[model samples]
Target: MSPLSLDLSPDLFPALTEAQADPDGPGAHRPALHFGDRSLTYGELAATASPLAARVAEAGRIAVWATPTLETAVAVVAALLAGVPAVPLNPKSGESELGHIVSDSAPTLALAAPGTQLPPALAALERLDIDTSAPTTSLPSPGAPDPESPALIVYTSGTTGPPKGAVIPRRAIATTLDALADAWQWTGDDVLVHGLPLFHVHGLILGILGPLRRGGSVRHLGRFETAGVARELSEGATMLFGVPTMYHRIAETLPDDPALAKALARARLLVSGSAALPVHDHERIAQATGRRVIERYGMTETLMNTSVRADGEPRAGTVGVPLPGVELRLTEEDGTTAVEAYDGETVGEIQVRGPNLFTEYLNRPEATAAAFTEDGWFRTGDMAVRDPDGYVRIVGRKATDLIKSGGYKIGAGEIENALLEHPGVREAAVTGEPDADLGERIVAWIVPADSQSPPTVDELADHVARRLAPHKRPRVVHHLDALPRNDMGKIMKRALTHD
Candidate 1:
């Protein structure tokens, strides 16, 4: 059986198309984007982007040098307008990684803002310098692209090997954004603010495209700052989107900065994703600002699966319920779906099937086929437990987060959260090292609140045993200045070792 074709709205980006068709509409004067001092109204965006899209549409595939700039946003908007698949390249990627992406994606052209220098990896492709203000062409109906056609080929982090491209279809984008609108009660009246990068799903799709799809406005901080976040929220930005790191910083500074707390309090919605906002930070922010930050669960392949809804309970340590159109379930290791009354203690791999899912892994048929179950559900490889109320709390990754010890399955997240509750512990990560007695021993990595007087292994171990179970306690402890983290604030557990 073939996958269902999206066939949602004829135009993938209905709001932008509406602006293009009627430049003089009532909301035409409203800002579509705000980056630093630069701005683009919905009407202006349509006019500027449609003409440039003519150049982009001609390419079989295009590579976008995704920078945190207005020009980058315009370039992507134009790609969608022209129905061309745009592959966003992270500027921070090393030469080898960039080379691998360019060679694998095989783009006919590369795009970036005028005067932006090009790296050697992008040199092979014909480069087009985008000048947003200078362009002219008759805009076509955005229904040009087939629903199944790839809109973006977003590459994975390639932690295990060379990066594989996830071919996101026009259908996935529309389905996801629409589902989010329903969950968030979002509308044209809302204004969003974020300072995330452009290459990833959290920043580009949810942060930027999500607003555009809803006819709402987005204000990008260009670079994240505590002051900028406060300023935007104080100036009537209704929603704030950020990763755990940004929220952590806000939590840290909220005591001394009443302005930041005030700003967060005024915002209608405060969202955190990309990584779990530590329970410690969550409690601190809620206590100081009276605003509980909501967390959403998503991936590069599946744009967004679940979220804590606006009207729902703002539950900490959970990713809330599945979106309106998404179907999510937990599966045991043997491919059996767990439908029993969930006690929120038993962990299983998350499997989902929905219109919001990506079409394929570009050029990797084997990997793509292996990623889905026999019944067509996507294997997320994320360990999570669903509460009876249906909120899903992710424990950790199946490959890294699950620790098998003395006949029990332990989730590193629960232990890390437990360690964070300790007054002397600032940050923590847990991993299982080989042990002759238990098969695997839990090892705890700690960034102590006071390095000069770090907590003893016995003290921290006893702390965990008391909070959770004794078997979950760390068998060994190592002190570090800081835990290794990725750009998104997810700790790199693979980097840690017993030695």
Candidate 2:
């Protein structure tokens, strides 16, 4: 089939017209989105959005700063139809990070929820107060989007340094949604529960676009609330997508929720990505919800490459096989072939080339060039291996998450994943510390499951000894209530490494 045949068309907002045609489409008045008490139907949603998109066109870039809601999704679609790039910033981000993003994007217009505080940078931009109460001008009719036109600019998680906006083309958005929907088996009958941040690709494309394209119902939750999530699932949802931390919280808080557990048993699918899922947490969520959590692999650079299936047994640590149309490989820094087979235990840097990959980093030509191999695969910067079944298991970040201790190279994720398996441990982070004799030694910072019964150093050491190789064990263990993480729930290893 031709590539365009798989495209996601902004011009076709069936949820908009379908609501008008039937006035009572599947999600018409059936709680399409809930942020606190505010609710909007499929019909009411399209009406509020069409005019706001026109106002967004007057500005060069539309910066959306609001708590996640169906309303936020409305604004995003309106901005795209209006033919301007949408820049969604994290409302909970520190002023410094927010300022950096606003300065980098230089939005022509800024929109925020009624009483939201704007950073100094966004405050300086022209503001268009959109009244959802009044009918505004409709978006100017347009032809097919310019294949190269920028639709969205998603910033990286900044694991390396400051985050840069990666320019995603209009075509790339459609490409990613098409690939994800097919791989994840999304259908019009599905009701997807969305909880990830709108600014990140893991949420933007996967949480929102992937479901919308399939004509599925998207139920938006403003943020992760263990109680609220259980309530939503009890109300009826077929699919759930979240990060590792979210699953951990749900597993911890809903041990006795039989109704919610039953709902999970009935749900068609469960998904986790954007970060690694510890084997214990994976098993806990599955056993609690009675459904396997399908873990996937992808990044902002390449929207999504692989996923474990809902029906398949989630191999403890693997991220699963590559999505259709995506080609993957492992290579050395010098660009030569590093590995040839899916050995289940080998490790190397992961790379991919596919229709779903992004066009470029906004203006960083050097960074863009450096991100790809000479053979044209986008370097994922992740160290991983494929199993005999072609399932991909992520080891750690190639540059920073790998620690050299004694004469062995160790994956920090390997230790962290094992540590999380202990019933007493709530969370864990492993980093290499300088050693006078061994050159480097493993140090673990753990968050205990119970504050009153935090494990002793000896207990933690014994736990690691049983789960890891002798050389991979931690020499020092420190207990902390919680580990530091960014907006996307990725453990801030850089901070631990430096501290």
Candidate 3:
């Protein structure tokens, strides 16, 4: 079959129409979404979203109360069908964060499930409660909006300051999904299962809309439990998508749970994203289930840049080649010269330019302009190295993960990976502290498997030195109960307080 092309136009909602038509088979009657005991067929999903789309079409922009339920999925779909920009609000966000988002995006209306109590931050907005049981209405044949038109105003995690909305255009979503189809060998016959939150791109965009675009089905676990994932996959779910945290739990359970291993072995695809899957977990899961989990690289600003191709080797510790139509390169820290050679030793910041990139930061033109170079490459601020064959291995983020020690540009990710391989270490994070001799010294923060008999700092340092190089070993160590992590399982290095 020819690769799916997304360059034709900007109407992403048409895929839903074709999905309902059951072009590939009896897709219209097939289950499109499943959350707990509730489910929706492709036909039902379209019917339920049409009337709401009509009502929402008049609004310039709308806020969606993003709960991990079928209603949240339907609300986002309705906004897309109406060609209105949807701003997803995290249900678990604090009052201050929610207030900041509301004031920043200035959404005219807020859409939530029927009977959902509005929070103080959203209570002031005009509210529209979605009733999924409402009868279907015929939508006016409004053609596709301009490809450049804003489809979403997704807010960033307010790690730096107040959250900034990233204006994701229709073209970016269409292109990224189509590119994934080409890379993953995705088709209408596939059924994807995940339990990720609906507020982020990984869950809301890729997990939900990806299946719909391919005329496939999705089953949401609602809450991530290994047994639930195994049950669904055993019952004919073709793929499983999750972050590192979920996979870590799965890895821990696989040794004692043969049934879970068997179910995983039956799956066609196992993907890990949002954060890097530690090599230790990768090896452990592969040993028990004989299935290698594929890793993909992406961010909120860039929907997806690269992924391990379904037909390609499932190499550990690498995120594979760039997706079709995505132009990727590595530039020096100065951001002027591009690193052309791929010796896989030198680490440089990743820069990309593609239709998959967000248009701009909403109401922050200066920040948006600063994100791109004069040549139009979006400065991703992620440090990575490429192999001779073009596979990109991300070292870490430029800000927190890069450590300059004794004139060597070291990446903390490798040290953390080496530390995880130690039997006594359950979790690990690495940072650089000011050092009088080496310019910066490597520090290891560890969660030990046995608190009473934790590995000594010298032993852990030697383990890293032997696994990698002596220079990469940690000079100082601190034991912690757990690493500070975000919802996606990515370690929040900025949250760590140094003594």
- Judged by lDDT, which candidate is best? 3
Weakest ten-residue segment in model 2 by summed lDDT: 134-143
Off by over 4 Å in 3: 1-4, 13-15, 19-25, 134-137
Cα lDDT of all candidates, in order? 0.88, 0.74, 0.88
Tell me how far the alpha carbon of residue 318 in candidate 1 is from the true structure, in angstroms, after superposition: 0.5
Per candidate, the number of residue pairs that clash is 0, 0, 0
Q: Let me know the TM-score candidate 3 reaches against the reference structure.
A: 0.97
Model 2, 1-499: lDDT tens digits are 1122465555435555565455445654443444556655555655566667656666778888755865567777777667788888877777778888888888878876665667776778876654544242233333445756888888886667788898887777777676666766676777788678887787777777666556666777777776666677777778888998888777766587776677777768888888998888778777786677788988887888887765456676888877767888876545567787777555678889987788888768999999887878898888886788788888888877667778776778888888888889888988877898877888988889898989887787788888777777888887776788876778887676443
Model 1 lDDT tens row, 433-494: 88999999999999999999999999999999998899999989999999999877889999
**Candidate 3 residue-pair clash tally:** 0
Candidate 1 least-lDDT 10 residues: 1-10
Task: Please give the distance, in angstroms, between residue 316's alpha carbon in candidate 2 and its true position after superposition.
Answer: 3.0
